[model samples]
Target chain A: MRKYLFIYKSEIMSELQYVFNILIGFIGYVIILFIFLNLWKYIYNDPNELINGYNMNQMIWYVIITEILWSSLGGRKLCRKICDDVRGGNIAYNINKPYSYIGYSLFSHLGSATIRGILYIILGMILGFIFLGSFPNLNILSILAVLLSGILATIISTLLIIFIGLLAFIIEDSNPFYWLYSKAMLVLGTIFPIEYFPKVMQTILKYSPIYVVSYGPAKLFVEFSWPNFITIIFWQLIYILIAYGLCAILYKKGVKNLNVNGG
Target chain B: MLMVVKNQLKISWLSIKYALIREMLNKTTFLTNIIFMVLNNASFIVQWIILYSLKDNVGGYTFKQVLLLWGIASGTYGVAHFFFKKAFSLSDTINTGKLDSYLVQPKNVLISAITTDIDTSALGDMIYAYITLFIYGVTLPNFLLFTFFCIIGGIFLTSISIILSSLSFWFSKSDIIADTGNGLMTNFATYPDGIFKGIVKILLFTLIPVGIVNYIPVRVMVSFNLGSFLIVIMATIFIVILAFLVFYKGLKKYSSSNLMMAKI
Candidate 1:
């Protein structure tokens, strides 16, 4: 635990050095948010018209919350690191270390993300306020639920990314897999709610990782309900087990294969 | 002057040829990248389709017009990345002093630098663009006009990247600035311009130039406007010349990394 804390602290300190870069990166997010604001405004035509059960304000805020979750998770960078390590034979060096590689990855990523996530959320909320004239109405309990679900979503996202990276054991590059997964999340979950998808896709996506990783937190934030919270928590628990179980199996098999090849 | 231009063209052609061959060395990865990129880009269209199903038009853009907008955007991006991918990464090349290789070579440094690599996935964008056009009803004139506009838009996009990246001459970490600028261009290029009004619309035309890249092209293609077509051509030429001037001016401040490397 202490070792992991040290790793986390180190990552946060290093990330802090590039504060300007962090801010610059947010420019893209802001521009996309601006476009969405205008787009939803144009689409609504009437202020009171509800599209897919969401008012224009709710729709834009939904996009904001989901984008925040997506950006702050740092799954792409983590997945790239794992893919590079496995492909470059650097994973062999880490396997002999005292700490669990998966734990190290998770803690370090979360530590780096903690600062970034907070900054992004604050920026996103400011943008939301500026565009929509207010923030989402939420009680303290609902906000707490959103935060908890967000953390679980981040973990599940990171685990799934690690699973994709582990595919390097079989394939030469795992980026294509990551690309497909990310597009699914972006199209199905982040940019629009599942309700906005086709009826068939909505049903399928509800059972997929997109439901837990992105939709759950954003959905709870916009319109909190006990039934939805319970459902999301149940999905999160299942995804956690599946992600962990898959990673363990793949990591063991991958390391053994690497050893046999004298890597 | 003609002789110089001819020599530079030959050198650029050779650089591109070698880059393509190098990429082809990993044929499987190349094909996978192209295929997956097409699939990824197609997913965005699916989202738009869903949106269109709910409404007749977005910002006065019918579903078919939206298809043309994407076709132009993806096609222009394809031309830039497929031919001169290093234009986007020019800041890193300048900051890290990787420009040393081009300097040592006896060719047009800017041309050589940007033409030295091919992003295979952009080929997918090119194919996807043409497919979208075919779906939008391909006529002989429409096909020719679309291809011409794509070339103009591609040049404009690359010029924007070059102008932004040339800031590395004065700033230490201008790469981030360049990236943000490029991101803005890409984000704005995809959306219908009718939604933006007043100052934002003006800025899009002058500063970011997404208007020339997509909006002007889309409008010209739809209505055959001679005035707008000429404006796009002139803007593209002006930007290209400006990019050259900025890059050469910055070359005076470029210091070498002193690390020995070779262009493959």
Candidate 2:
């Protein structure tokens, strides 16, 4: 645990050099948000009107939060990195390393994401305030819970993505798999709240990882309730464990298949 | 001058052909790349399908019109990436002095610099574009018009990337601008133009130019009109010319900063 924390801290220190790299991503996020803001305005003739229990502001804010998370977590960086390491045979050097590769990936990614996420969070906040005023009604406790859930959401997403990255052991490239996963999240929850989806589809998505990975915190931010908070947090916790366990199993099997050539 | 233009076009075509032949060496990778791209695009359209299910229209676009807009967007993207993948990477070329090789080449520098590789996945985008067009309802005339728009949109999109990416000649680390420019063009082109208002709408028509790339083309597809068609043609020519102008002008400031890496 201490070694992981040290790795995480050192990675953050090293990641500060790439602040400009992350901040530039803000422009892409702003454009997406701006486009959505306009689309929502056109959708709801009245700003006060509600669709599936969300007003224009709620819808817009939902997009902001989800976009921030989506942009911050990135779609497939870790998976691609893992695939590269595995395919390029660089993972063999770490075969006897003191630290576990999965732990290193998770920490290093979080380390970098910590910087990028905070900036995007700030950007998302400012953009939300600028485009739609203050966030939809939320108390301090709910806000804290939402933040906690957001962190958990990132963890689960990271672990799952790392698991996909580990697929470099068996399959060729994990990118094709990641495309499907990311697109599901994008259309299902990141771009639009599940409420806009049909009733039957909504129920399935609610139970799916998209709910815990994306919709949960954003939904809580827009509309806060204790019951929803408990359910989202509980599911987020479960998914994190499930995702991490999957990554560990995959990494173990992948390492066994690891063949290194050229000393 | 006409002969020179034809020769340059021939050279560009040859460069692209050779690039395709090289990619053909890896048949499975190339085919998978194209297929995955199509699947990626199909996944995104599902968002609109869900949205359209709830609303009859979005941003002055009917479901069918949305399909047209998306089709043209994908077509333009396919054209740009498949043919001129380096246009998006022009800033890197200029910054790292990769442009030096093209400068020394006898052929047109911009054409040579851009046509060195193809993004095989963009071929999938091309396939997806036609799929959407066919689904939207295809006539012989409609098919011809769609092909024209895709060809023009491809050139226009490439020119947009080149013009933005050429900024590296005057500024250090301007790759972000180029990347954001590319992202803006690709992302905004997919959305309906009617939703954008005020300065953003104007900007989309002018600077970012998704309006010219997909919006106007989609309109022409919906209802054929000579004036609009001519505008598309003229706007495309203008953008292509403007791209050449910007790149050449920036070239004056370009200095070779190659770091001893041999391309050979």
Candidate 3:
């Protein structure tokens, strides 16, 4: 485990050497931040009119939290990378190594995700301060819930990515799947809150793991309840266990073919 | 020039057929596209329901009026996707060094590149939009005139797509521009143009230019304004000509070596 920790750290250090690329990525995030801020600002032009349960400030806070949660734990690109590796024969090299392939991927993904999480949180903090001025009377328990949700969001995202990436072994050009999945994230990830959805869609979303990742956590941070908080944590554990089962099944099936293409 | 166009059309047809066949055979692409189309339309339908619940008209558009606008816009976007998906993926082609193959082709490079990856899945959106339009009880146009407008709409949209895509040659990456352009168009196109005021309205007419795709024709169709429709036709011709000139000019600085077209 210590050795793998070193590997993960070393891998991240090398990637950090591409400082320019990381900076470019940060610029991309900033652009999205600006777009969302403007969009919300337009919607909240008159905060006095109470639309739904919350005012403009609260609604925009939802936008901020959702955006941060998404940026931090959205592992779509990492999934694509995993798919690329599986299809491109890079996974074969890892399989021949001493550690488990899933373990290696998890570590590598963690290293990168830690960086993204930090970047997203710091950016969100700055934006929140600039716009909302410090905290909005958020409690310590709510803060803890937010942190727990963030961790679960990361796990759910990583597991979902790993599952989809494994599809590359069975298919040609996993991009079509990746593209559709990413779009699904737009709906599922609270780019528009699930409340905006129709009754049927709301029902479907309630049970979807996506809700736990984005909606559950964001809701907790904004409106705290001990029962709902415990419920979300329970769902997270359930999802994690299911994800582990899926990983084991998919890896075994994918390895049976063992026909990795490209170098 | 006439001969160049004729030959380009012929080659584009062949490439389109080949791509359609490839996509049809590829179950993954076909199924994924189908799911995406359904989900996209579903989201729009949900949004419309919410908006319709609040009021009969949003920004001066009746429910059916907005549906007509969406029908035209989404149908036009669908057709664009159906035939010119490769052009839409210009950044990918450029980044992956796949542009070399298109460059080597005997046909117009842009036409060939665009026709090569036809997205037939867009047909679903086209069908859905038109069906909705029909269900809304829009009066039937003279068949010949409707056909003429459809052709003009296709060309106008293609011109806009080409101009947007050609920016990739000048920039390191143009995906963000493409995405932003598409997002803005999709968001704004649902509402009537009359809602937008001042600089934004003017910007939509000029800079974004999505107004050319659905707004003008649908407006004319609804009001039966011959003058406006004719103006739209003329504008379509002007833009297509402009797109060609700009693309060819950009080709001059192409520098088609391995360095410019870096392999992914």
- Candidate with the greatest DockQ versus the true structure: 1
List DockQ, one per candidate, in order: 0.77, 0.69, 0.20
Candidate ranking under DockQ, highest first, comes to 1, 2, 3
| lDDT digits (tens) for residues A97-169 of candidate 1 | 9997787887888887887888899999998988878767898998999999998998898888889988888
Indicate whether candidate 2 or candidate 3 has the larger TM-score: 2
lDDT of each: 0.87, 0.87, 0.69
User: What is the C-alpha lDDT profile of model 3 across A1-263, one tens digit per residue?
Assistant: 98679777976787667545444455545545554555445445476566556665665667677777666654677777888887777878877788877767777776777776777778777876787665556787678777887778777767777887887777755655655565566546555667766679888987887687777777776666889888888888898888768877888888888885555
Which is the better candidate, 1 or 3, if ranked by lDDT? 1
Give the range where candidate 3 chain A is weakest over 10 consecutive residues by summed lDDT.
Answer: A36-45
lDDT: worst 10-residue window of model 1 chain B: B255-264
Model 1 - which docking category? Answer: medium
Ranking under lDDT, best-scoring first?
1, 2, 3
Error of 1 at A81 (Å): 1.7
Tens-place lDDT per residue, model 3, B212-248, is: 7677766766677878887887888898888788777
What is candidate 2's lDDT per residue for A71-109, written digit by digit as tens?
A: 999748788898899888989877788998888889888
Model 2 chain A worst lDDT run, 10 consecutive residues = A168-177
Clashing pairs in 1: none
Q: Model 2 off-target regions past 4 Å? A: B1-7, B261-264
